[model samples]
Target: MKKLINDVEKVVLDSLTGVQAAHPELRVDLENRIVFRGGTPRQGKVGVISGGGSGHEPLHGGYVGTGMLDAAIAGEVFTSPTPDQILEATRGVDAGAGVLHIVKNYTGDVMNFEMAAELAAVETGVRVEAVIVDDDVAVQDSLYTAGRRGVGLTVLLEKIVGAAAEEGLDLDAVTALAKEVNARGRSMGMALTSCTVPAAGQPTFELGEDEMELGIGIHGEPGRKRVPLASAAAVAKDLVEPILADLDFTSGPAIVMVNGMGGTPQLELYILYSEVAKLLKDAGVTVARNLVGNYITSLEMAGASVTILRADEEMLRLWDAPVNTPGLRWGA
Candidate 1:
């Protein structure tokens, strides 16, 4: 209820206004609610784009730039972008090579993006492909998704696939790499507290001070279980264990992320990260590169998610490529 906004209905547009002001290097389309990498599209490079509801800042929108997504569509908070909005982004970002839609596994997102892809191909003759990120090991079906919900692994996938596209890979190659990244990654999340969506004017869910929700989704959906609040180490164990179980990380060097769900602070995130690292090491999982921060978040929710990607040489090389974006920038 204590949100900083002028009006509930205008929350998304108002936030987009701030995004436009804060990141001048990017192009913001207020009407369509799309954010694009400023300037002309790369002639031969595949255009990489993703989108989802608002609230998960630094996600689809914050990632639009060099070595990452070329454009990102912003829907209403926790809502899917309409097919027309998605088609607009697809058409705008498409150069000669084609466009890649990196959609999460949410049903609404999946359906809308599919419809947009069909429209773009038939109406505009722009080749479009999509990769659905379903790396959450937490649940097979949620209120919003028929399969596992795409969570933190989305950030990692976007960076790697965007690097491939920036390298001038064809649409087919870029899409393949994206699918590979999605296949290799697994994520699990936990929440210490719930968050209030701006329009709702109240918390999405409530959690007792002494309890925590394990295997939580990014949109405040019920997690796998609620249990007594535990230590960082115990929480890390609860998260990392499922991911390790779902995918084998011991085969090769891995890319790991301990992402905050908006409201969690860095101090606590590092504490949790250290414990996660310890667990991975104990399991003989070799971590090559790691990111620890709030790359993807669930608006003001106090929690964290762990994403592990089993990486090979190509993934590692692409991951090391320079990226320039508001949410993640390095080497550029």
Candidate 2:
């Protein structure tokens, strides 16, 4: 409720003004609220784009840049972008090689992106494909999604697939790789506190001081169950166990992420990662690459999520590719 803002309805618009000022490398469309990679329509390269509600910063928007997303559409807080907005992004980025839509498994996102794809094909004749990331091992259905709600693995998917597209892979190849990445990843999260939407001006949910919600969604949806607050090591077990049970990560190298839900400190994240790394090691899951930070987050929510991707050599190589984006960058 005590957020720094002029008006509730203008949060997205106002913050986008800052994004435009800060990251000139990204072209921000104030009218449509779409952030496109600067000098876009990179001909012959498969265009990669993703979108969802706001609040999850550095996600669909913060990722637009070299070796990542070509465009990212932003909606109101926790609200899906309309089909018209999505179609505009698709049209703006396509340069003959086609476009890939990386969508979370939320119901609104899925439907709207689907509509946009169809519209792009019919109206602009731009080839469009989509990959739905439903890697959350926490629940099969949530308040916003029919299947498992996509969580932290989305960041991994965008980076890997964007690298593939940057490498000049065709639309079909990029889409296939994206699907493969989604298939290999699994995620689980826990929340210590709930987030407040700017418009609502109050916390989305309440949690007792001595309690934590395990297997929480990014949008403050109810988790698997609430339990007594536990130690970092115990919390790591609560997250890693379901993911390991869902897939066999021991077969090969894995890419792991310990992501903050927004309000958790970097100090606490590292402590949690220490415990997570040990658990993966004990489980014989070799972590070849790792990210520990606030990559995807709910608005000022006190929590963290774990994402594990069972990776192959190609995935590792692409993951190491140069990326220049606000959210993630290295080797650029």
Candidate 3:
């Protein structure tokens, strides 16, 4: 329950204020908690808008910039944004071409974004395409329980899909690329500890110092099971093995990201990545490119997730393309 904040109700607004101050290329709506690129609504390009809860920093919001998302709406911590907020973001960023909504597969996010897209079609004639990322291999991908959670792979999805849109790929092509990216990626996470949600004012779940949750989803959801904590190398094996087994990333060159879940330290993440690299090499899988850091996170949770994307030349080309954002800036 220890959080440094003036008020729980003001967390989203204060964060938005700080974002505007730090990133002048961005515009913030104080009342609506919507973040827009400084000069959005490009005459012919597709408008890319994405949002979810506020806890996952650099997610829907941090990706807003010249080469990524056009706008991002923020919801309460770990809660989905309202339909009106999403509708506002969609309509505000819509240009003549169309708009794309990068929605995570969480139930609340899906429902609210779908509602907003319906409203947008009626009100503004904005053709909206939503691509849900369900790259977490922990979930069963069943017809129940919200399907799979969108974890680390959403970052790669936004970057690649945004590039396609920027190149005038049209709505169908961009959407196809997005779906392809999602389908080709798989992720798995493990948490050594739990986190407090600020507004919830308590730990979402409990874990002893020696207990680890193997298949963790974001937002403190129940993992596959709890077991005694293991070494970094062992933990990396557990996380990466499941991801590789679920997807055939070994078929070709791959892009890997050993992402920390907000609370894990860099030293430990690298230790884990060392093991991941060795394992891939042992399996005859070529590591074309890799990112090891906190790209997507569950607020203040001590854990990490490993994502592997089975990359073709086109995907790798987009991955190498220029990207400029507060959280991730490179290649440009």
User: For every candidate structure, what is the RMSD over all alpha carbons to the true structure, in angstroms?
Assistant: 0.8, 0.6, 1.5
Q: Give the Cα-based TM-score of candidate 3 against the true structure.
A: 0.97
The window of 10 residues in a row where model 2 has the poorest summed lDDT is: 246-255
TM-scores for every predicted model: 0.99, 0.99, 0.97
Q: Compose the digit string of candidate 1's lDDT tens values, residues 96-123.
A: 7899999999999999999999999999
lDDT of each: 0.94, 0.96, 0.87
Model 2 whole-model lDDT (C-alpha atoms)? 0.96
Model 3 agreement with the true structure over 1-332: per-residue lDDT tens digits: 77778899898888899998999888888788899988888888888888999898878789888678888999999889999999999888888888899998888889999999999999888899999989988877533237788889999889888878877788888888899999999999989888888888899899987899988888888888799999988887898888878897547898999989899999999999999999888878888989998888888999999999998999988878887888778876
For residues 234-287, what per-residue lDDT tens digits would candidate 2 score against the true structure?
A: 999999999999996658999999999999999999999999999999999999
Model 2, residue 166: distance off in Å is 0.2
Query: Model 3, 273: alpha-carbon shift in Å?
Result: 0.7
Clashes of each: 0, 0, 0
- Residue 209 lDDT, candidate 3, scale 0-100: 78
How much RMSD separates candidate 1 from the native structure? 0.8
Among all windows of 10 consecutive residues in model 1, the one with the lowest summed lDDT is 38-47
